[model samples]
Target: MRPTSEAELSAVISDATGPLNLRGGGTRLMGPFAGNVLETSGLAGISLYEPGALTMVAYAGTPLAQIEAALKSENQRLAFEPPDLRDVLGTSGVSTIGGVAASNASGPRRISVGACRDFMLGVRFVDGAGAVVKNGGRVMKNVTGYDLVKLMSGAHGTLGVLSEVSLKVLPDVEMQLCLRIEGLDATQSVEAMSAALGSPFEVTGAARGVDGSVVLRIEGFEVSVRYRATQLQSVLARFGAIDLIDDQERCANIWRDIRDARAFASGDGDLWRISVKPSDAPHVLETIGRNKATLDWGGGLIWCEVAKGLDIRAKMRVAGHATLMRASNETFAKLGRFHPEAAPLAKISANLRARFDPRGLLNPGLMGAAI
Candidate 1:
């Protein structure tokens, strides 16, 4: 079912008797759900944009490309650097802004700035009972109390169906410089990233590829970028030889590849995304014992490919969470899509789901068992 307007969306939900699998752009499909498809693509458009204020408001189903174009025209961007997962996931449809929020998608820059939820200012969603709930506002300071704006993000439509979102944007930088340190092992690479990230150079991206090359990005005015690059090179010189990539297009492509995890886009192995303290990254790598992995967010986020049906979680001795990002339906059903929360946390999540989706009809079993 596709609803063209908010009222139509609410009516459809209000009349629903079973699970409703929420869909936006059809790009990041994580479901083998038992429910009628509820498409939000029809509810697409930018409702507001203030370049001076560095803010944007768009309907949940609005294509991400459209919003990026608009932001680019004004020399601004969604600083969180949300990744385009269509290629990695092998999906064809356009990516929607709602999906970005639902997944809390962020790229390497996330280590410097924040995640998708950090930029969100407000949200308008239809709860399970078809009740329209609006929280927060266009400006950052307008958000107070419960902070449902953040609550809606990364919820994956379990609590409610997002209809619109307000976000904070950042001005685009004039120059970008990437410093590459080659031939470093995982531990050394993480140390190098830690040094760069800890520096005052304002490194925006830190990632290590399967090729054993560490890339750190610095952005701002041309002179500032050049100055910081020099400083960063000196700091990282102890690690290895540093190659400065000043070409605009080349740097963009480098980051784009890291952002999308292009390394693991192919092959038949199941993909897993593990999040842990940056310092514990080396141990996690040792535990997983997979050379085919991409470290982003300065090693806080690890994307590893493992053979299907192999439970990486069981092998993990680190204190972190692992999500089964890509797998067959059977593997997903057996292992579950997300890591099981601890008993106390699981109870809190269950109570939240119960409060928002009283009927337990919204994306049931997509994140785990139904509410």
Candidate 2:
């Protein structure tokens, strides 16, 4: 089912009988696509775009491509760099802006800027009760009470179905440059990434491929990029020959691949995304043992391809969070898809769900048996 407007969406929810699968372009689905389905892609178009204000408000079903194109025209872009899930998910579907917010998707630039939630200024959605709810506001710098805007950002559409969203955007830098340092071991890679990130160069991206090649990115005015790249080179002279990647398209492709975890997309095993302290990454991975893993976000984010039934969770105890990025249906069925929550946090989650969706309706069983 597709509703082109909020009123249509509310009416659909008001009449919903059982579990309804909320879909936005169907790009980020995990587990089975059971139950009746509702698609938000029908609700499209940008409601507002104020380039001077660096703000854009679009209907939830608006294609991300549209937003990107519009932002590009104004020399601005989604700084968080939301990932396109089609390639990684091995599915053929265009990602919608709403899906990005629903999944709280962010990419390579997220390390420097922030996640989708950081730019999410406001949202309009339909609650489980079929009521039209608007939180936050159209313009930025809003402080009008309960921040349901954030609560809904990564809720996976469990709390509500997003009908519209307003986001904060940043102007695109004039130039993008990268330094590829090769031959760095895991420990060395972690240290190098940490040093680059801590430096005043304003490094925007840091990624280490499984082959021990680490890439560091810096973007800004051409002069600033050049000067900082030189300074950064001097600081990392000990790391040895650094190949500069200034070619616009190539640099973008590499960063885009890193942002989307495309490096592990073609691998055979199930994929797991582990988030840990940047400096603690090497130690954590050493304990996890060897499995094809790519490090991103200056070692804060690790993408590992582990085989089925490996119980990858038992490999480490970093006091960090782990997400099942991509896995077989059987694996999801046997083991919980997300990190196991402790009692205290689990209680809070339950309360939030009950407060917003007491009937246990929206996306039932997607996030741990609903309520």
- How many pairs of residues collide in each model? 0, 0
- Model 2 local distance difference test score: 0.87
Which segments of model 1 are wrong by more than 4 Å? none
lDDT of candidate 1 over 1-371, digit per residue (tens) = 99999999999999999989889999875848888999999989999999999999999999999999999999999999889888777788989998898888888888888999999999999999999999999998896789898888888999999999999999999989999999998899999999999999999999999887999999999999999999999999899899999999999999999999899888678889999998899898898785488898888999999888889899888889999888898998898889988988888888899899999988887765797
Which stretch of 10 consecutive residues in model 2 shows the poorest summed lDDT? 27-36
**Candidate 2 lDDT score at position 12:** 92
lDDT of each: 0.90, 0.87
The RMSD (Cα, Å) of candidate 2 is 1.3
Clashing pairs in 2: none
Report the C-alpha displacement of residue 167, candidate 1, in angstroms: 0.7
Candidate number achieving the greatest lDDT relative to the actual structure = 1
User: Where does candidate 1 have its weakest 10-residue lDDT segment?
Assistant: 362-371
